[model samples]
Target: MTANTLVNSKLVCVALNDKAQLAALEGTFNEAPYKKPPTQPVLYYKPRNTWSVDGAEVEWAKDFDGNDVAEMVVGASLGVVIGKETCRVSAADALDYVGGYTVVADYSLPEQSYYRPDIKGKCLDTSAPVGPEIVAADKVATPDSLSVAIKVNGEQKSAFDLANMERSIAELISTISRIMTLQPGEIIAVGFAGDRVAVAKGDKVEASIEGVGTLTNTLGGA
Candidate 1:
């Protein structure tokens, strides 16, 4: 259940669920200085090397020259696997294309804000931990209405209602599809909120969504 990809490559795609992508897109659109919503959908692809299996230990690499040292976020995002090729589909038809949902931890060592480039910090090996189980899309009727939170060592660190998302899941899917066809099993990770804290070795991380359940992993020093 582990996947790997090369560094700084565009061909590798992390499997993020639709809801995750939509939440991130909304955050980006709302937080932009211009205050204008995106006319088109935005999508970010993580390299394959980012994938880490459930319960696998995450290594913190030493601060190398040219690499900024900072605490990375243990982001827990809901991931949706596409079941069909969907292009400009309607909201009513959106769930039909979704194969299922899973829990994913999108580890983020942000080198800069969303406005700046962050390929190295985000694409590092074992940066993405995904799994537990794939819940069918039908199992959760209202994907956009779920609650999400993150906990470190049983302490609540982050929490939010999906309703807080500025853009609706349907809108994001429809918008993204217009730009590119969505294939079965491809993932779309929703973004995280606030400044991410630094995690050291032996830290237990948990990401929980109301309907999708929690994904847990431990951190390790390199």
Candidate 2:
């Protein structure tokens, strides 16, 4: 397993799970193609090809959307690792299926509209740097109240608290399980909120979650 992930695991990320982010995209969602905001968990994926290890030199992302993405976002997140097969579970018992937690830096070309995801922009190799280490679930008593921060070149760029999440960890796991069964080793990136700072090539990026762990990476290569 790469970067402590279990074999055949997938990285699932939630979006618009915070009030600020939802408000930021409200107008767009209420317009044309979409007449309303999503009621259920808005999920996305970072498949195995995009997985990067802690301290790895990540390649810059591409603009598959044709915007020629001038910058990308270093999304500081807390990753929930699944311990067993979970489907149609209850929020009260969701933690029982969680194996542990890890730090994840989700890199992506900024989304102009959330309607359709830009494949190459979202799934580029070395885009999702996961795990410095996994702290057992029991160790993280309050997964939804942790603080996550992002630093570029040692300067604080962005920071947000998991308390801002519209859905708690238990809710996300329980709600998401109803649609897809999460397998052992797969991770649920609870998502980030507010605004994200734009990053450029050669920047030293660090995403940290106090007691959990820190993941650092450098944006480089083609």
Candidate 3:
């Protein structure tokens, strides 16, 4: 299904390990050094425009530099699909709200700042590719300790264990629910632990999660 058909409100993509990401961000916040990391979940909503199904083609539109500039970064992350309307949920009951899990490849252009949301940089067409299949949350043996990785053209560029998340999936869901009500079919892309790599046209990107399976997509030049 298309993103609009699957989601009604927003798709929250958590930015875990706030300190590492902040160190990479391009600018200052409030004209001061942006040193303090968010104590709570750092969430960014990727609208339907950014969603694409697994195996779909994601367009890497040429930039002001023309065809030579077709490139975007891919963030391979575990995703939680909400099973019901969730609001003010508790960490203890957070997983109960999850319907299933899916692999998500969050695509975006290189940006230097988090002080402001970069709509165009992140919400481009086919930016968030999710699927392969949704594994029921209960069936995911250990969602908190799965292995995650990203590959480009069949070569692994980055690999990491979810064991390192600053906040577990349950805690993230609980914190996020307090910020906004999540509806059925909407998703929360659990944060990535390491660096995201840039991919260009003609490249095939794959996001693999140990239990959830891999989501693959090809990059096409616009």
Candidate 4:
């Protein structure tokens, strides 16, 4: 596993009670129009079987019906690790609860407009490539103002100003805490920017933020 994928990215240990099914969690962020602090934090989970580390590759699978699988989505998100137990936190005190930050590339096969209900499309092995390193939160002055971008096959494809995020970093932390207790070392990935594209085998994916360095991985067949 690469250091960039997990360090500071909140890793939540889950249990699947039934033998036939696995537990999963989906990563989320606020989209525009709903900008300014989110009224509430958003969350979703994938079956536990779908996680993978850096350097691993995911194979494209055909659905039950015979149709060429057209697209997939890879989400590169900024993860925030909570430093202390926080519940019902105030926005002003949110930054103090952060332990650090990391980068995670969340992958989904065969692009679908909605993220949930399409869990099978997203939870494939080796789809999530994460790690490089975790930069301490103290090192970043304004987490909400950082610049994030992505490149595929050395071509720039997606870019977003962190300032444009629907919700500020601190606000998200505070808002989410109210729903569930955020523990030390727990992770929270900032949502993706508007740009989403398709990728294929042999392509290289790179995600970067201004203060946080880049994490790169290549797509390949199983």
Candidate 5:
């Protein structure tokens, strides 16, 4: 499916699934009253209000001081589209249910605290930008090691390698399927590593995955 059809799908993102991100939050998760690392992936809702498409120009949140051209956090990640209704699938068989992979740029405000749900920071209108196209599973040779680079205004801000993911993409799919059934067209945004890139208003943000294609968005005002 294309980016325009992503609006018909549901999205919730997985966090701390990357080595860098998990390491960043390790101390906090270890220090909490619970005093232990989580066995399951940390998840957050990216409700319908947050969905957008490639090249979409979205409004700035009130947190941006009503300016669209301000620095916002952008995490470029790989999204796995569920091919069929899946529940309790094994990692070995998970790929059988994958539709394909697509580039996902999940935007949010800065200063997100991992201690609680970041609804205000994450679930804003057009915060989740999906696009380019879905590259078939068999088409991508190295799904585990895809490199994603983020450039703002044609300048590279950060480039993250998917090789550092704590869980293999298939493993995440299998684990998630055990808890709840995922329908066709549903998306699971695999995690991203490194700090979220900061992009200002009018910045041209491009998240490119060589063979997979690029998902580009420019921050603009209402």
Candidate 6:
């Protein structure tokens, strides 16, 4: 809701089932680790610098190949906002800690591996654009399954449903809490199971999740 409210909170991203992408990388790199999909939630952090509100501009400039203004992989996802301190919670009771849900665009530079933290790729300024509003958890008809879509420059580029996620919202919360404590106001980006394509400067990107909300951001040169 406010930057002050989220000062100490963390933004965690989860990968539900990225087998196809992983396998593709394995072939390109001829590596063993990418041969199979991860069994658990593959988590990464989007630090405070990445935080932005809906309608904000997401700037990108670092090009890994050193050509052109860098494009980003835009991930449309559901964001679950934590309402209370959570630790070792059970899947059955995980919803109790949720404050609400919002739409988040998880942006990052194109990456080949998830083996190590890609701080430069993901933790960039305005990489995580969240919210125009927070729909109280109880308002969402079915948190587990919702239609999600992404558009760049007014052209629809990707579409999918949250129902395709490998884990339920509660299960994800239960699983993540066992590893680290989640504080109030923190957000868990429940993962994007759809296509994530690169977008360039001046592209107006919009990511929306059914029943939750929609977030719009303009990609600009850094």
Global Cα RMSD, each model: 5.3, 2.5, 3.0, 8.8, 2.7, 3.1
The pairs that clash in candidate 2 are none
lDDT of 5 by residue, 1-222 (tens): 224546345885888777877777777778865478788888877888788888887546665466443457788888888888989999999989988888888888874567778887887788788877888878986788898888887888878788888888889889989878899888888887558887676678898887877888877652
TM-score of 2: 0.92
Better of 5 and 6 by TM-score: 5
Q: What is the TM-score of each candidate against the true structure?
A: 0.78, 0.92, 0.87, 0.75, 0.90, 0.87
Task: Give the per-residue lDDT of model 4 (tens digit) for 53-136.
Answer: 555564554565855356666667776777789899999999999877766666677443342445567666566655566788
Candidate 3 Cα misplacement greater than 4 A, ranges? 1-9, 18-35, 64-70
Report the Cα lDDT for candidate 3. Answer: 0.78
Question: Which candidate has the highest lDDT of all?
Answer: 2
- Full-model lDDT for every candidate: 0.63, 0.83, 0.78, 0.62, 0.79, 0.78
The candidate, 4 or 5, that scores higher on TM-score is 5
TM-score of candidate 6 against the unseen true structure? 0.87
Off by over 4 Å in 4: 1-39, 46-50, 58-68
Could you tell me which 10 consecutive residues in candidate 1 have the lowest summed lDDT?
Answer: 5-14
**What digit string (tens of lDDT, one per residue) describes model 2 on residues 196-217?**
6688888999999998988989
Model 5 CA deviation exceeding 4 Å by range:
1-3, 64-71
- Residue by residue across 115-189, what tens digits does model 6's lDDT show? 778887888777888886788988986887787789888888888666677677899999999999999888988
For model 5, which pairs clash?
69-201, 70-201
lDDT per residue (tens digit) for residues 30-137 in model 3:
255456655566678788777778889887855655654545788888888999989999999999999999888888887556657778677777888888877888
